[model samples]
Target: MALNEQLNKFQKQQVKCQSTLSDIASSRTSVGPSRSSVPAAISQRPVATAPVRFSNDTVRLTEINNIRKSPVGSQMKRVIQLLFETRQAFTPEQINEACYVDMRANKAVFDSMRNNSKAYFDGRRFSYKATHDVKDKMQLLSLIKKYPDGIAVSDLKDAYPNVLEDLQALKASKAIWLLYSQEDIAYPNDLKCDMKIEDDFKALFRNKDVPTDMLEVEKELLKIGLKPASNTAERRAAEQMLGVPSKSKQKKKKKQEISKRTKLTNAHLPELFQNLNPSGSQN
Candidate 1:
């Protein structure tokens, strides 16, 4: 009787295990395939996204609205600030792009600003005009002559924004001279004293066989009691006047020559063979 009861208990436990497995299997089938059972490539596929698009007119209108929301004083101040930061002339369209200011809407403010001494408008573009006590061409010339050594073009431009026009006029009239190097330099023509070159020295220079090397030429000039331009600025100016090419150009020419000598084509073969048999006694 005891063995039969023990066998009945074992059968009941086995039946419970089978029902639990069936429930698990049914749940998996209802939920579809397990994540682990799916291929990794299909499971990790990327989803496509649509791009956001905007029209130019829409963007410009949005910018203009934002500008309109700002205070009147702030808008004007922003335009002025943009001009000062760039230190360059800008058209109405350019200003609008940079500062989002609607030139058409703020025409009255711009007109007043242009009429004022602070801003300069040349029919199309606007720029900041710095007040450096240089009002006219005479004053500009006086300022340039004040610096005996030479004044930098950048400083002059900073002092007077319309300096280039005046400089061109003055240069045409022989009132001033310009030397362009790493930094452009302006000199008053009246201050320059012309050097007197003797006929004998001129003849010497014409007749002398000077070396192509600048250093050697300098030494040769020194030996003849004549001074070559010692200052770098003077040397560059002299080279420019003589139409002499710079060292970099000279180096490029030398490299071209070397390449030509080294590069042999079919046309060069006959000449090379003839040189190899200079006596024409080859079998």
Candidate 2:
């Protein structure tokens, strides 16, 4: 029994020593001074290189010609802007198609803008213009300057809320082309689509509880020569004062009107004379 017990203790010690030696061997293998313990070798790292990607193999022009272009030139300033505004320059037809709506609906405004925009300047190209088919921000600002009371930032945004970039550009460029915005206002209860620009603007202004900033705008507009409407009640006053009164339309042609009057007058007179006169006179 003693011999068996001694043998069992020796076996346990052997197992423990084997475990400790195995740990030491692992540590030595990881960080070794002797090359023979673990053979030294160098393997390729096989690094990941991004696949070569190539695109649009063209050089771009950064500068522009200083000499202004003719108004009718194919590459005039705004047209050039329209070209570079997006990924590609738009075709002439694209520009035309955008502005060629029923412009007669706002003939007074469209004509004024079209005629005035021609003399205005473009910020980037530093060129003068004679015509602007599109209702752009700068052009709109010029009109607002002429009629300061008639516009606002909200008015401009409502006019073209979809054109965020244009509004942002106006801000970034520090172009003062508009009346300062009053606080957004509630719509009038009795809203009408055909309200005159002045009336509509004032209605919105009043409904906003009369924002304090509006006082400055009102003063600025007055300074710039925008007149308050002589009378909001006088819809026809402008036409009347200008002697351009619109005539009421008549459905019948002048010849048809004359014929109808002649028939009526002749019908009564002929019956009376036929009863009193001879056959030859009647015929």
TM-score of each: 0.30, 0.16
lDDT values, one for every candidate: 0.69, 0.40
Q: Which candidate ranks first by TM-score, i.e. highest?
A: 1
- Clashing pairs in model 2, backbone N/Cα/C closer than 3 A: 83-89, 118-129, 118-130, 118-131
| lDDT per residue as tens, model 1, 122-240 | 99999877655576799999988887788888777756557789988988888888889999999888734767778788676666775866777778788999988865557789999
The CA lDDT at 208 in model 1 is 70
Per-residue lDDT of 158-206 in model 2, one digit per residue for the tens? 3332444665565455443323335532111222444666766756654
**Clash counts for the predictions, in order:** 0, 4
Question: What are the RMSD figures for all models against the true structure?
Answer: 26.5, 31.3
The local distance difference test score of model 1 is 0.69
For candidate 2, report its TM-score.
0.16
